[model samples]
Target: MQSDPAAMPAPAGPRENRAVLVDVALALVIGWILGAAAQVAHWSGQLAPGRRHGPGPTGNEAGHDWPRWAEGMGQPPPGVPWPALIAAVVILLAVALRRAYPRAAFAGALVGAIGYVAAGAPFPVTLIPLALCGYAVAGREPLLRWLPIGVLVLPLAVAGWWQEAAVGLTEPGPYGVLLITAAVLASATMLALLRRARRDAHDRERREELRQAALGERLRVAREVHDIVGHSLSVISLQAGVALRVLERRPDEAAAALRAIRGSSTSALTELRQTIAAFRDDPGRGPTAPPPGLDRVDELAAALRAAGREVTVERWPDPLGPLPASIELAAFRIVQESLTNVVRHTDRAGAAVLLRRTGDELLVEVADDGPPLAAEPTPGGGLHGMRERAEGAGGTFAARRGERGGWVVSARLPIGEAP
Candidate 1:
């Protein structure tokens, strides 16, 4: 199981829910707007031309009548009685289900269209429901490239051609209805595909970010292990050597050395576990131990002092203000790792640590007054670990030969505003 939040698929939040509702609402709004536009075009034409194409009753009315189209607006095309109201209900149901069920929505829209046609309603009015389902079909159905245009557009066009368009109201002609239906469905389909493409792109970016975060997290754990176990091992090795040297003639000194080894090992184990658990978080569970920070720097120096190394800590600005845990922890890790390298690589008992708060940044430098380092500095796990810790905490890190002699490790870490 992935422990990272970025790795998990996001739940549909309020914004997504609102978006779905908006799509459904837009169906109704778009249909009404298109219906009204058709009305406007119908009214734009003269009543004389409409009388040519529009149906009417006898020879006297039909001859030279051009046609007999009525001009009005009602839910069921201005005639055909109260039974035609079911068409509106079915169309509304189709619109509501468009996002959730494309096939079913399409079926409902078709049924409603058939109902309106059966009621002697204008075919252009029925095209509204059919066009509304385009979004759902284009988004969810396969063969989507031309499927929506073919399936949705052709039907509305055919129905308009077969029926007297101005059944009760002067509506758009078959060609007008065809163009309007195709335009709506095509627009809806294009919009749906665009939304899908954007969503897929967003998901890809999120996954890439999660991959990078997981990689960075793993590196952080490795650094923690190197700092914790590496220092402990170094201390343990030194203590063991001392114990061996004094065991023959001085039992008390050897016993004290053994105690130091035990202490370091136990502390290392406890902290190692805490660091591991911090990353492997679970519901209602958290790291049991507080992370080591600058407050523990004195304790680190004291430990080195007891281990026969003279380690001194100098803090400029006397005392730092309350610091962010991240900055403090990074500083502590750098100091710890730097001191460990001094013991393991240099045959010296003296190392100096400087901590200074400079504006929005904190500067930490650890320099050992030992013999000069190699001209070509060899890369080691300890140095790499220290560098990673500093940079990982949004800091700059460099380890080079000191001006005078020995090795100097410096880090400049960003310190955000204190709580």
Candidate 2:
């Protein structure tokens, strides 16, 4: 089915439409008030005698006919020096329509200005409507679209000034019209540029926010993948080595080692699927299981032991109680990554895991009594990941060589309301 292009809905949202309506309405009301004031000045004779271009007498004793300037330029039709109320209505309508149809509104306003001048209208409130239309045009249309309008309006304005001056109404020159036109165009252009700059700043801010969100999400996925795959693979490697060593004599032990490897691999696969589902934004699926935390430190230590490391866990103050889930998860990952590093780099090194609460902070430390690995760690490796995880959870992490001659990793995590 064919659809008419003219029937398409505007891209502006409801909020933007309302804002435009309010602005246009305010401009209309302001123009009407100014026009009304000019009408009062005309009635009170505050303005010059011949300035009112109406059909009635100009109050001049000579009783001259219509001015020569009114010959070529069209005059308002009969009964056309509209009352203040009718003029106000026309001005209001023309100003209000400026936004959606800037060119048409501006042209209509210019015609109205000509009629108002020919009618000898008391005050030139029409200039307000024209200026507003120019502003709207400058804001929405490109320079090429409205630049010609500016160029054309200046000459017409100069002619109007010349007519006023020729009749002894004001000083004779194009300078007055030139000044007014320049002011109007400059004001409109400045406002339009400011609005454009503000919108550009807002757009840049919005794009930056989206980019940061995406980067954070990617970092989260990377952290999860590292913790799950790295830990499971480390366990599988140890079990596979045990199985190969025992296959000749201890058949049952070898079989047990193979079963452990199967369990670790299965667990790794399940977690990987969950991570993938999360990335795909699946509604029905959530995290497959709660994240490992401090409560699972013993299980983690046992796994490290199985990986051929001597591991000891010490908890200060007996019962550590419950902590925030984020803190617990960060602590667990720190210990897990530390253990993994020891297993991968050290040969049966002894490591200690410590958890303690002091003041408003929970401290977690992992240290291995082995020389640092000779291989240079890659950027954003296990240690860097652990530090990011801890700091991102509103904590502080530090890793340094222990006084006893081994690498030590420590994190001080806030428990509650601690800076």
Candidate 3:
């Protein structure tokens, strides 16, 4: 019995699930760290008095020199009960949605960054979520779409700095902040592009592998169809010719030949349908019938004898032990093709088939005792296919003129036993 190909297990789900989990966990961890840092900076600002206006007693601020938007305003800044809570929620939401909806998450993160700046937060705190979102967007979106967005970072930073300057609230480090923001965005975009390129390379390699595998399967099926139809048609053609020649003198013999032709045609049609169905990917078609093998050799010899050829088969190891079906099929095809060649190329030739198993190898040999034909036989698809089948089964095949002056074909197939 043949097993259904559809019954094989699928391996895609678990790997994809694991990747999603990893991305989500990493996002959460990064969001947590950024939120904690923002909270610490907010607390430091609250504890220091007049520090936003000028340097502290140490002649330097606790954070970098970026201008603070809240310090220059005449009115006191509105207080939030939990400033970190808003930033944390926004950052986490953006990260969680990054993989599934990258563009939306990226836009949300940009809005959050603008809100952070407007709320008088530190510049470094605003950068965390923006950088993460930029990376996500670059990874998913095409270069033409995301590259321009990345380039806009420089102009946006300059505009914000210019607004601060118009109000006489600009610090001496406007260019420093602009360059830093641009560098962050550029670096994130470049890394994401590299990752996308690597993923594309891997996808291409996988597709190539699948294509080559499909091509190899096609060749294998073609070879099988060629051997089956070729051998069967050869037998049928020879039988039809015999039936035509004897139709006038021997009516009974002609009838028998016609019956043999019908039998061969019917068997070929059945096998052709099975071969085609095997190639179909539909599970509803069910299992295919087992392929022909050594057990059918007797039926093959009988058919040839009925077609006016004298053929003998010998099995030295009678009641042969179990063998792999592939080896058996290759063996059967070699013998079948050899007999078919004899019928086509020789007149009244008698052939002998010998099958023997010794140790780890199964041997098959076919020899004909007829005199050489007037023309030398040219190698054709049959000979090339036989060699391929034997080698594909991890076996060896040879065809040459025998010492007794007739064509001999031989093959030795490995039986999966330890050598």
TM-score of each: 0.71, 0.77, 0.76
Ten-residue region with minimum lDDT total, candidate 3 = 46-55
- Give stretches of model 2 more than 4 Å off: 1-12, 23-59, 62-78, 81-94, 103-123, 159-173, 273-288, 372-380, 417-419
TM-score for candidate 3: 0.76
Q: Can you write out model 2's per-residue Cα lDDT over 223-319, one digit (the tens) per residue?
A: 8899878988887888788889899998988888888788778978987877667577667865567666788889777766664568999999667
Count of backbone clashes, every candidate in sequence? 4, 4, 0
State the RMSD for candidate 3.
7.2
Spell out the clash pairs found in candidate 1: 51-66, 51-67, 52-66, 52-67
- By lDDT, who's the top model here? 3
Error of 1 at 198 (Å): 2.5
Q: What shift in Å separates residue 396 of candidate 3 from its native position after superposition? A: 1.6
Off by over 4 Å in 3: 1-78, 81-93, 155-172, 277-288, 369-379, 404-406, 417-419
Cand. 2 TM to true fold: 0.77
Which has the better TM-score: candidate 1, or candidate 2?
A: 2
Candidates in order have lDDT scores of 0.71, 0.71, 0.74
